[model samples]
Target: MLKDRRILITGGAGFIGSNLAEYLKESNDLVVLDDFSLGKKENLSGLDVEIISASILDDSALNSIEDVDVVFHLAAVPGVQDSIERPLETSMTNFIGTVKILEMMRKKDIPSIIFASSCAVYGNTEKVPVDESTCPEPLSPYASQKLASENMIKNYREIYGIKGISARFFNVYGPKQDPNSEYSAVIPKFIRRCIEEKSPVIYGDGKQTRDFVYVKDLVRALSLIAEKLPDEHVFNIGSGVETSINELAETIINETGCGKEPEYREKRAGEVERSLADIGHIKGLGWKPEYSLKDGIKETIEWMRRSR
Candidate 1:
């Protein structure tokens, strides 16, 4: 659908962003803006696209848009636990930074924006599979900031005529997810530890469930959003299946042939008990998750092994 259209992606060097860039660069004109604070250049090394080494915190750096068709705002301080430890920084990057991008897009007359939101905004809810209609009860500053960004996008759509859609992503994982970072997601960290023959550590009872969506599925969803341009919309992108930390660890061990067991530890503060996404809305858009947890885990193990 993106045939020679100019597209800009923030955080294009990160896990999900890099995957999206690779998918779009095959047929679309692509430009990537990232600060390299959390994203690695190595993740984008082989991709043939223009790379802007800049921060979203700097309005001028984000203002250099030229004839962009769509802006995919995927840049932010990711992770719920990290936000609790650094609330101020999280708010600045996620909330204020998104506003800056919106303002710049408005000035540049960008047609539409696909925002990368989170399911953590639902918090610890009684709901099994959280949908877009669920009222957000954010448990951490990061979730709060992401919710604020979605609100900002909606407001901009109403006031400034900037078309936008917010995709609430569940637990996303796959190749190129940084395992060495302090805020690495659960799946990659567990996979890395298993490959090293070390016991993977899980907080609490390891029974807390999450909907793990593969990066490629999310990339396809992003591309679909850009193509469809639904009017001021929101959708959930996930696998539509809830898997616990313990179950996830077992899958990784079995896939990697790791002979170590998982170690349970004290549950961290602000951790959600369970989360799954009701992906009916996105499914209506003709987009469905192709990678099962087992398939994704096996592919991730291969990637991790290659990287090591």
Candidate 2:
């Protein structure tokens, strides 16, 4: 049923968005709208994609695109550290931008939308495998913005009848991820540093753990979730397993055969010490992560090595 539908993937030139676009474009009519702030144009190469170079906050830009059946809202100023330095930009793009998208959806009468929320909303909760029932305690401005967006989306679903699903992503990594980005995730940054034979940098004691979900797995889960339009609007998308930063660095080093040592820096503020998701909800939607961290990291390193 999702096939042949006209889909809009905002931030479509980005790592996750581009991968999702590549996977769906073969089956669905995919239109990509991106401002190219964090997204890269090269990611869209070799694919016959309809590209609209603009921000989701642009009313004129959002208004310009029409006839959309479903929208995957991936446009935002991403990352915890990035948001810390520029709260206004993060709030504007992540929160205000989501409002604009929802308004556009309401105006266009697009009945369903999939928003890119984050597990960062869980904050530093002691619960190892936090579920949707766990109250969100967002520590950073970015996390707060995502939570606020989720509430607005849920409100729209109730009052306006929009099938809005908020997907709270864990640490995601894959081929198209930009390691050079100032706010790059640990996996991609670690992979690139390892490939360059540079010692991977770890913030703080390096024991802070994260549940890493492979990008392809996330893309598949999003597709399955879209097919069902599940009863609940919130889901934690990740591998149920957790890996510590120290262990993660070790694995990356062994995989890439890069420098064996790692340098430790002060842990960035608002970083959760531990985060793992209970995937029972998403699993009931008929999807599970196919890639293990080891396997996923190997593939990621292979791609980075080749691309470099």
Candidate 3:
């Protein structure tokens, strides 16, 4: 569906973005905009595309692109703990940056956009599997900003007639997820610590449950959304399977063959107790996640082992 199409992917050097870029580059004319702040350039090392080393916060970066068919907006400061420490920066990047992109899209009259939103926007919901109908009660600044961004996108679509889809991603993990960063996701952090023979640290009782989706599955979903732009649509992109942090640690330990246990730490503030997605909307669109948690973890562990 992406054949000979002009596409712009913000944050295209990050884990999820790079995966989408790589998958689309074979058939689409790709342009990547990333400042290399959190996203590493090495993630896009072998990809054949136009690389613009710029931040989404910069208007010039948005102005540089022209006549793009689809803009996969994925650029943002991601993480609850990180957002707690730097709320202003997180708001600027996630909220203001989204506004900037929407304004540029409005000016250029871009037909469609597939925004990469998050399940964090749901906060600690009474609902087990959050769907698009769930009322968003964002608990952290990061979640608030992402929710705000989604609202902005909806507003733009309503007022400006710019068609789009907001895909609320669950806990995504796979190859190219930055393991060395302090703000890395739980799975990568645990895998790296285990590979280094260091004790993997777990906050709280390691009972916090999350739906972990593979990067490849997420990329495919994004591609599908881009190809088929359902007017003002919002879909939960996830595997619909919840795994506790304790189980995730055990699985990683087994896969890595490290035989190491995770060290317990006090729970961080604003951490969600559970998160799972009701992906019925996306499934009705004829898309479903292919990777199981165990298979995705095994692949991620293999990548970590090779990287080290």
Q: Provide the TM-score for each candidate, comma-separated.
A: 0.97, 0.96, 0.96
Clashes of 2: 0
lDDT of 3 by residue, 227-267 (tens): 87876478899999989999999988888888778899999
**Clash-forming residue pairs, model 1:** none
Give the root-mean-square deviation of each candidate in angstroms.
Answer: 1.2, 1.3, 1.4
Model 1: per-residue Cα lDDT over 1-308, one tens digit each: 55678999999999999999989998998999999988989988888989989998887777666889899999998977778889998899999999999989988899789999998888888978888888889878988999999999999999998998999999899999999998888899999899989999999999999899999989998998889887637899999999999999999989989999899899987677888899999998889999999999999999999998
- CA lDDT, candidate 1, residue 283: 90
Sorted on TM-score, best first, the list reads 1, 2, 3
**C-alpha lDDT of residue 122 in model 3:** 88
Model 1 residue runs over 4 Å out of place are none
The global C-alpha lDDT for each of the candidates, from Candidate 1 onward, is 0.90, 0.91, 0.88
Q: Candidate 2's residue-wise lDDT over 106-170, tens digit each?
A: 99999899999999898888877999999998988999999999999999999999999999999
